[model samples]
Every structure is written in structure tokens, then in C-alpha cells.
Target: MASALQYIEETIICAEILRLMPRFLALLLRALIKRCLRSHEAIYVTLLPVADQRCLERDTRNLGHDLPKHADCIQWIMESSSRKAPWSGKRVVHELMAIWFGSVHALTTTVTFAIHDLCLHPEYTEPLRAELEAQYIQFLKSGRGLPLLDSFIKDSSRLTLVESSILLSLSAK
Candidate 1:
């Protein structure tokens, strides 16, 4: 269980790092280039056009197959683009990247902080651990049917979010 938690923490941190990489690179570019290269602008001008083309081609190829629906950003881009006056691939890519970064950061932060809170409040630890064990397989299969785990995560997230807001307020002074 300890190992599992450690693994999860490491995975979340790694994912968070990966999710921020574009912004980090853009910051580096802004620093080195001596100009304000916003991350989205940098990404749009550099790589997203190619990705958008690839995504469009793939979706076109899979039009008849029973594939999962497109991601929201990609779907919107496809809807907006046409034979003429096409949507900018950069915008599509930027929106997708933004969503990825935001979702990963929010989820990882919530989970990490909640785990920290669980550590501090040891009384809830055993019950939570037991609940996790019981629900682990089910969660793996259906990603649901874990009310206890959900409640624990929500409670932990709430407490940690409140604490973080307080800390942020203090530090801003």
C-alpha cells in the first residue's frame, strides 16, 4: 500500500511536469529570446499545425469505424473548419494543450494535497486504506462504485484547497 501510494504520487508528479512542459519551454523561449512569447502562441506557431493535420486525417480515416468520439477541442475545430476559410490548427492545438495542462494540474494537485491531509489525519487512514483495497479492482474496471473513496477524496480535496487558499493569501501579502 505504501509502495502503491508512492508510485501514484510519482506518477502524478511526472504527469504534472509533462503537462507544464510547453509552458516551461515557452518561458525559456521568452527569457532567451528577450520577447514575450506566450506559451500558446509558441505552441501554435511551432508544432500544433502538424498535429492538427494528423488528427484530422486520422478522424477522416476512422469515420466509419466504431471509434470513441473526438475530444472537445478537436471536435470543435473540425466543426469550425471547412473546405474554405479553415480553422487554424494552432488554435485547435492550443485549446487541447490548455485543457490537458489544466486538467492534469487540477487533478494531481487535488489528489496530492488530499493524500498529504490523510497523512496528517491518521485516524482516517486505515478506513480509507481498507476502502481503497476493497474498491480497487472495481475502480480499475468501471471507474465507479467507490462512494467511500470518492467521499474521502472530496473531503480531503476540500480541506487541502481551503488550506492552500489560506497559505496563498498569506504569501501574497
Candidate 2:
């Protein structure tokens, strides 16, 4: 349902098809719009309370990076929306919903691809599991921990970051 909304936006850009195929476009648009509306309603119900909390925070201004409570992405979007023309409740809800839809799409795609890759190479699964079990926390910025997990995800992305570089260099020397 959420994904249909994304496709509908893309479909709207080519206006010729919309004009040429009224019945088909109308059916598609009607269905997607209905789904989007339902998604909006569900997210709005969840986000209204958070927006209220944001309004409460507006007066006190716990708006600093130093503040521990200011960690939520939905809160950040609400705070950063528009100072000149404050967004309506509906607009805010839509924004939050859009963010959630994007996040969920990314998560699902990555997980799907990862599962496929893991199945393609079964040998790394146990070592990767062991690496995760040994580490309680990972500091990805400094690369202080969880090298195996990092390499597992990003090694295919970049050739230089692989652990086998050391062995290759030793063989050459």
C-alpha cells in the first residue's frame, strides 16, 4: 500500500500516459490514493502524540544537540519543517509517514539483498554470527569493533576494504 503511493508519484510525472489511458490511469490512481490515505491515517494516529510532545518542547526548547531526548528522526523533521509558515498537523503527519515509508523500504531491500548474499556464500555465516555474539556494541566510525560485520556488508561495495588484501600483499612480497 505504502509502496503504491511511491509508484503513483513516479507515474504522475509522465502526463501523456495519464491523458491517453483515462480508465486505466483513473483506476490505478484511485486505488493508490485510497491506499495512501489509509497509510496516512495509520501514521497520523501514531504521530499526533509525538507532535504534541514537540509542541510542549517548543516552549521549553530542549532543542540542543547535547540533549539526550532529541534523538528521534520524527521529532527532528517536525522541529526543522518551516519557521515562516508553520506546517499544519496534516502536513506534519504526512512528512513523518513519508520518512517512515522510505526507511522501511530501505530496510526491506537491504535485508532482502543481504539474505540472498548470505545464502550464496554459506561459509561466512558462522564467523559472522560469532563476531556479532562477541561484541556488545559497535563503533563503525572509528572501526574499533565488528570488522567482520562491516566487511560482510561493505566488502562487495569496495575492493580495497577486504581482509584478503593482507594475504595478497604477503604473497606478492
Q: Judged by lDDT, which candidate is best?
A: 1
- Where is model 2 more than 4 Å wrong at Cα? 1-37, 41-76, 102-113, 126-143, 154-173
Give the per-residue lDDT digits (tens) of candidate 1, residues 6-120.
4333334433433445766744533443232233344445556666675666566556655455565567655665644555666566555545544545676777777887788
Off by over 4 Å in 1: 1-41, 48-86, 138-142, 159-173
| TM-score against native, each model | 0.46, 0.40
What tens digits encode model 2's per-residue C-alpha lDDT throughout 27-78?
5754554454343454466667777666556544645534335667756776
RMSD to the true structure for each prediction, in A, is 10.8, 14.5
Please give the range of 10 consecutive residues that has the lowest summed lDDT in model 2.
Answer: 162-171
Question: What C-alpha lDDT, on a 0 to 100 scale, does residue 102 get in candidate 1?
Answer: 49
**In model 1, what is the error at residue 63, expressed in angstroms?**
19
For each predicted model, how many residue pairs clash, with residues at least 3 apart or on different chains?
Answer: 0, 0
lDDT for each candidate structure: 0.55, 0.54
Write down the lDDT that model 1 would get.
Answer: 0.55
Q: Enumerate residue pairs that collide in model 1.
A: none
